[model samples]
Target: MQFICLIYNAEDNGPQPGTDEFGPYMQAYADYTQEVQDAGVMVGGEALQPIATATTVSVRDGKTELMDGPFAETKEQLGGYYILDCKDLDEALKYAAKIPDAKYGRVEVRPVMVFD
Candidate 1:
């Protein structure tokens, strides 16, 4: 089975670049990634650009519409994600808890749906 860990945090929250804690914060993520990879559970993961760089698109009434940034403002924003191969949801949640962001933000673990 596979699970996707959706990482969410406030854009202005957490350690920011040019700050003293930034380097260590990033290192923590690297260490977590390596730990998962070494354990053979990490399928893939990546950090996304800030929400300010996001573009939203929708189609209604046979017309295409584009919106800048997120459709709704929220305290937390989707920052990144990790796809992991795990034995089950229990295992996936275990790994999700290890994510660095889990401390200050949230890591939503959801089982991947397969079509056959």
Candidate 2:
């Protein structure tokens, strides 16, 4: 089975990039990345740009509309994701819990849907 762990966090809380404050988090995530890769569960993962850089689009009444930010505003924003191959949801959740962001943020584990 395949699972995606969607990471969410408050932009106000985390360390900013390219600063000393970000070092520890970088090391933590790097260690986590290595562990998952070594365990063969990490299929892929990436960190997303901040929500300020996002663009939202919607279509209504045959017209296209554009928004400058995300689809909706919230205290927590979708920060990144990890795709993992696992035996089942239990395994996936276990992996999700290991993500560094899980300490201060949320890791939403969802099984991938297959079409056949």
Best TM-score among the predictions, by candidate number: 1
lDDT of 1 at 7: 98
The lDDT values for all models are 0.92, 0.90
- In the range 11-100, model 2's lDDT, one tens digit per residue, is 877776888879998898999889889999899999999899999999999999999988879989999999999998998998899888
Q: What is the C-alpha RMSD of each candidate to the true structure, in Å?
A: 0.9, 1.5
TM-score of each: 0.95, 0.91
Span of 10 residues, lowest total lDDT, candidate 1: 70-79
Candidate 2: C-alpha RMSD to true structure equals: 1.5
Candidate number with greatest lDDT:
1
Stretches of model 1 off by over 4 angstroms after superposition: none
